[model samples]
Target: MTSKARLIYNPVSGREQMPKNVADILDVLEQAGYEASAFRTTPEKMSAQNEATRAAKEGFDLIVAAGGDGTINEVVNGIAFLEDRPKMAIIPAGTTNDYARALGIPRDNIPDAAKIILKNKTRKMDIGKACFNKKTQYFVNIAASGSLTELTYGVPYEIKSALGYAAYLIKGAEMLPHLTENEMRLTYDDGVYEGKLSMFLLGMTNSIGGFEQIMPDAQLSDGLFQLIVVKPSDPGNLLKLMALALNGKHVDDPNIIYTKTRSLKAELIGKSEGKDLPVNLDGEIGGYCPVSFDNLKQHIEFYVGC
Candidate 1:
């Protein structure tokens, strides 16, 4: 039986090039030995995710997520929980395309990125499962919470499309002087950190916001997450830590809690006063704090560059 492929893409992402590239992308998938179809995501909330779930249920052999990281996250979340998840591929169209960078997939050319499926060099990928009470969500690369991380969320879409990671830097600087220190108890494989923290990050891949060394110890399928908890510091001290992070040596800093864990739980402490400390999952606001994450090791297979 021939394998069937579903191409789910966000039409408005980046330069909106997917519509023009659809035919070529499908041809590339066809050349890789599959009967492929494309689905342009609508604005009807979770459209990509819904289509992804439908395609997976229909027994598609491959589900190719084409667009920015957000689109990829939706697709992954749609099927990551399934017992029999289909293999995945990516054609990046977002600003930074951090996950694609980690996969060694070409970001500038959609067809070239898809061509990786033909190369057939891939491995099982670790999926991060974040749970809040009865609800669950998933992440493909980085999950973070902090004032600086939240700044990126408020940046104008036009600026994001125009400047990419640089926009994050610009916005982060603006928000630093008024940073929000979250009081949370963070539990990891080693121990617990309960105190005031400026931010915490859980990374499944090394690349985040176009910074390759941000999570240097991250492994794609190790069934572990590299967790970094930044203790509360003034703007100047936080800037210093930021510098250290660029070289992947920030783990050695006293102000930073760096460790690896298969599971992690983050809960608000007394200082929080029951207010929500938002959790940013793969660059998007996933849910409130009190989130528990389990590293779903080798959960999804993918088409990665050799």
Candidate 2:
């Protein structure tokens, strides 16, 4: 029996590469001997996600997400909860192809990324479920909360496309001076922490924002999250820790909480008492915080480069 596949892409991501390379990508899928088709995401919210759901239900054996991390996250969300989800592939076309970077898939090359499907290399990737504000959202790369993390979505979409990773740097620098600590209670396996937190990251992969050292020990199929929590610190100390993170040496920092867990709960207390913190899911604002996270171990299968 011939396998079937669906390609879901964001037209404007990666400065409009998806549309231009559509034919080549489809050809690559064909070369891999799969019956293939494509779907273009619309301005209508959840477009990719809805399409992904439909395609998976229709019994496509493969789903190729050909845009940015947001597009991939949507595709994953569409079917990760299903009893029989399809295998996935990524064509990295975005400002910071964080997920692609982690997958060892080439970024900025649509057809080449699609061709990775032909290599027959694959893996089961862990997926994260975040629950907050009576809503559930899923993430495949990283989930974070804090003022600094706002940089993920704070950069305008248009600006991000044109400036790429530089846009995030600019935004980070601008927000650094104004950073504020939040009264936080973080609960994880074996222990709990109650203190001021500058930021916290739950990473399922080694790469984050184009840097791999932040979660150097992260493994896609580990069934665990590498949780990194930043304790409140002066700007100078915070900067120092960030520098250490670049080299994967921050794990021992006194102001950092680095551990592995299958689940976690992050609560905001005091000042922002009842206020909700925005949760960044795969670089998009997923929902508000006071959130709980659960790792679905090796929940989704995907074509990956070795």
Candidate 3:
């Protein structure tokens, strides 16, 4: 019996071109001897996770996400804790496609990816779980805090849709002058430390927004997350740090501190004086500090190119 494959598509992703490509993907999958269907996603009624759960219950052998990082995030959350999870596949139709990038999925070709999915080769990969207050979720990419997070939140959606990754640089320059360091108390599996930090980034994958800005040595299957901390210092030093990150050389700088850990907890130490500190998870604003992260090792299965 032929196995079923369901494609969850977000119409608004990647300059609003995902829907058409999803149609093409469904046709390709059907030609490859798989029972295929495409579902249009919406913020209100249906979600990628909802679709994945429904498909899994209906006995789908493969669940493919045909959109951006956020779309993949929703799908992963659906299958992460299931007893008999369906194999996951991706068709890179997003701006960054960060998770697909980490898995060696082809960015330019969709038909080829569909063929690989039909082959059914799989690999188990780690997923990171983050908690904020009463909410808990998993992310397959980086979780960041501080100035960069603020910039990510402040950037206009129009600008993001227009310039893509370049929007970050444009917004980061505007927010740099007003950015201030915050006091944080962080504890990991190794130890605890308190300090004024300019930035804190926990990387489960090598890149953020499809750019290798921080944590150059991060690996997805390594069973550890890379923690990078920028100490509070002069504004000039912070500028230098930014320049180094653009070239992917910040990890070698003496002022930056890097470590590998399985879990970490960070708490805001000092009063913000009515200022709201922003934190970002996979490009979405995830609340303030006082958040904790635990590594969910080999929690999700992925399809990778041979």
- Name the best candidate (by TM-score): 1
Score each candidate by Cα lDDT.
0.88, 0.88, 0.77
Model 2, which residues run further than 4 Å from truth? none
- 17-125: candidate 2 lDDT, tens digit per residue: 7898999999999999999899999999999999999999999999999888889999999998789999999999987888998888988677888889999999998
> Which scores better on lDDT, 1 or 3?
1
lDDT of prediction 1: 0.88
Residue 222, candidate 3: C-alpha displacement in angstroms:
2.1
What are the per-model numbers of colliding residue pairs? 0, 0, 0
Is candidate 2 or 3 superior in lDDT?
Answer: 2
State each model's C-alpha RMSD to the native.
1.1, 1.4, 2.4
| Model 3 alpha-carbon drift over 4 Å, by segment | 31-33, 118-120, 272-276
C-alpha lDDT of residue 198 in model 2: 85
Predicted structure 1: clash tally: 0
Task: Look at candidate 2 and tell me the lDDT of residue 294.
Answer: 97
Q: For every model shown, what is its TM-score relative to the native structure?
A: 0.97, 0.96, 0.89
